[model samples]
Target: MTSISQTTRPAYSAASPRSDGLSTGFYKLLFMTPTILVLALVVAGPLLYSFWLSLHEYIITYGMGDLVWFENYAVMMSDEFAGVSWVTMKLTVIVVVLEFLIAFGLALLLNQSWLKFREIYLLVLMLPILMTPVAVALMFRLMFNPNLGIINWLLSLVGIPQQGWFGDPDLALATVVFVDIWNETSLMLIMLYAGLKSLPQDPVEAARIDGASAFQILWHVTLPMLKPVILVTLLIRMITALKSYDLIYMLTQGGPGKVTETISFYAYRLGFRFLDIGQAAAVSFILLAAVVVLTVVLLRIMREN
Candidate 1:
C-alpha cells in the first residue's frame, strides 16, 4: 500500500511540473518585459547617449570629433560657469522660500471657515498655473513695462518712480523670481490645503478646549504635524525653481547682461546658441548632479521625520 501511494503521488506531480513551470515563467516575463523596456528607453538609453556625448567634443557644424575626456567638464567648472551656478542657486533658494511662505499663508486663509467664495478664489489662483508660462511671462512683461504700462501708471499716481521690471539688469532676476512665485504658490497652497483637510481633528479640538489660541495651535500642533507635506512642497518647488527657464526666457531672454540666466538657460545657450553639444551635455549632467544631491538630502530628511 505504501509503495503504491508513493508511485501515484510521484506520477501526479510529474505530470503537472513542466506545464506549471512554463506558465509561471511566461507570467513573470509578461509582467517584467514592459517595465524593462520602459527603463531601457526612458533611463538607460538617454544616460548612455549623454555619457557618450560628454566624452567627445561635439559641435553642431563639425559634428562629433575626437574624444576630449573631461575637458568639457573642466570648462564648465571654470569661474564664469561657477558664477552662473551661484546665481542659479540663489534664484532657486529665494523662489522656494518666498513661495512656501506665501503658499502657507494662502492655504491657512483658504482653510478658514469664515472665508467666502472659496471655490472661486481657488479657481482664480489656479488660473495662473494653468496658463501657458510663455503667455504669462508676456503678460507680466507688458504690465511691468517701464513706459506705457499699467504698473508704472499706478506707481505714478502714488508718486513712486518707475523701475524697470525686465529691462534693468539688477531687477530682471528679481522680477522673474516674483513671477515664478506667483505662478507656483497656488500649487503649494493646494497641496497644503489637502494636507490640512486630511489632518485628524481630535488634537485640534483638544487644543481649542485647552484654551489654545489659533496661533498657538498652529505653531505648536498643526505645523509640526504638517511637516511631511511642507517638505514635499519644498522639494517640488526647489526642483521646479532649479529648472526655471521658460518664463525667464520669454520675459527677459536672460538679457539685461545675463542677470536672469539660470542653469537651464545656460545649458540651452551652450547646446543651441553656441552649438557646443559636449559642453551642453556636461552642463546638463552637472545640473542633474545638483538635483540628485538635493533630492537625496530631502528624502533622507523625510525618512528621519
Candidate 2:
C-alpha cells in the first residue's frame, strides 16, 4: 500500500486558473453592455455625427458642398462672430453670478427659524419655473412693451419716467437677463434649501453652543460644507444660462440692434434665417467646447476642495 501511494499527483492551483479570470471579465462586459449601447446611441452617436458634419461644408438644402476643413471654425473666430461670442460670455457670467447670489439669499430666508407658510412660499417660487419658457417670454414682452405695458403703468403710479425696457439697445440685454434670473432663481433656491435642510444639524448646533454668530457659523462651518452643492448648482445654472435662447428669441428676437444676440440665438439665425448650416454648426461646437471646459474646470475645483 505505501508503494502504491509513492507516485502522488501534483496539487491543482485553482487560484491561478485562466478560465476563471476570463469568465469574470466576460461577466463584467455582459453586465455593462446595455449601458455602453445606450451611451453610444444617445451621446456618442450624435457627438460623432456633429463632429463629422463640422469637418465638412454641409448645408441642409444643398447637402455636402465642400470639405472646408477648419474654415467654419476660422470664420467663427473672425471679428463678426467674435462680438456675438463676447456678448454671450458676458451674459452667461452676469446671469449665473446674480442668480446664484439671489437664490442663495432666498434659500437662507426660507430656511429661517421663524419662517412661516413654507409651502406657500415654495409654491410661489416654483410658479415661474413651472411656466412655459416661451409663455414667460411673451408675458415679459407684453410687460416690457415700452409704450403701454404694466411695468410702465406701475412706474407712472410712482411718478417715475417710463423708459424702454426691451426697446432700447442698451436696456434690452439687461431686461432679458432680469427675466432669466426671475424665472430660474426659484429652481436654484429649491436646490439650496434642500441642501440646507439635509445638512447635518449637530455641527451647526455645536457652533451655536460655542457662541458663534449665525454669520460666523454660515461662513466658517455651513458654507464650507455646502460648497459642493453650491458648485454643482452654479455649474448647472451656468450651462442653462449659456444655452438661453427661447426667452431671448421671444422677448427681443435678438433685436435692439442685436444687443441681446446670444451665441445660441446667433446660431439659430445662421441656421434657420441665413441657412448657413456649416457656420451654425461651428458656433454650436464652440459653445459646446466652452461648456465642456467650464464643466471640467468646475469639477476639478470641486475635487481639489
Candidate 3:
C-alpha cells in the first residue's frame, strides 16, 4: 500500500510564487522605471541640450544665433588649450600619486593593533574633510598671502624671501596642488584605512610565518590582495582631480595670467566671463570625453592586471 506522504501533492505547486514569471518581471521593471526616468530627465536631458547648444553660436547677449554645427568645436581646435590641459594633468597626477602614497603609508601605520589613542588621532585627521571645501580654500588663501600672512612672516624669520604664493605664475599651480592635497588627503586615508581593516588576516599571517618582513609582506602579499580596493580608490581620486575647480577658483581664480587655469576653469571663463556659451559647451564636452576615455583606459589596465 502507498503511504499518505507519497499521495500528498507538493506544496510548491505550479500556482505557487515560483510560477509567477511574468508578474515578477513586471514588478522588477516597475521598480526600475523611476530610476530610469530620473536619469533620463536629470542627466541625459541636460547632456543632450548642451550638445545641441554647442552646435550653435548661442549666447545670452545674442539670444541664440544660427546653428553653426561643429563650428564651435572647429574654432577650439585652432585655439590654444594646451596650457589649461597641462596644468590639469600636472594637478591630477601630482595630487593622486602623493595622496595615494601618503594615505597608504598612514593606513598601514594605523592598522597596527598596538597603536594608542587611535580614535583621537583619527578624529584629528578627519577634520579637514569635515570642514567645508570653500572654507578650507579661503583659509588657505589667507595663509598663503605674501604680505601680512603668517606663512610669509615665518619665511622671513627663516631668512627666506617673501614670494607671492598664488600671484606668481610659476608657484601658483604647485601651491594650489598642495592645498588640494591637504584638503582631500583625509578622504584617501579614510578609504585606505577601511580597505586595510576589511582585508583578511590569513594571508598576512601565512606570510609572517614564512619569515617575511613587514615591508616584504606589505609589498608582496597585502598590496596584491588590496588590488581591487586600490583601483577603486585611484579611479575616484583621478576623477576628482580631473574635475577640480572650486578650490582652485577661490584660491587663484585662474589668476596670475591664467597659470592655474584648468579645463573646467576654462569652460567657466568661456561661458560666464566671455559670454560664449556655445564655445563653453564645446570645451565641456571635450573635458567630459577626456574623462570618459581616461576612465575606460584605467579600467582596462585594472582588468589586465
Every model's TM-score? 0.87, 0.84, 0.87
- List model 3 lDDT by residue over 1-305, tens digit each: 45666458554244335444645456667899999999999999999999999999988797899999999887455435777888788889999999999889889889998999999889888788877878989998899999877998899999999999999988998888888878999999999999999999999999999999999999999998888888878888898889988887899998889788889999999899999999999989989998898799788867886
Q: Which digits, one per residue and each the tens of the lDDT, describe model 2 over residues 104-147? A: 99888888878899889988987888888999888888887878
What lDDT does each candidate get? 0.86, 0.85, 0.87
Any runs in candidate 2 off by more than 4 Å, and if so which? 1-42, 301-305
Better of 2 and 3 by TM-score: 3
**Candidate 2's error at 221, in angstroms?**
1.7
Which candidate leads in lDDT? 3
Sorting all predicted structures by lDDT, with the top scorer first, yields: 3, 1, 2
lDDT of 1 by residue, 206-300 (tens): 99999999999999999999999889889977887887788878987777887777788888899999999999999988899988988997888
Off by over 4 Å in 3: 1-22, 297-305
Give the lDDT of residue 139 in candidate 1: 86
**Candidate 2 similarity to native, TM-score:** 0.84
Query: What is candidate 1's TM-score against the reference?
Result: 0.87
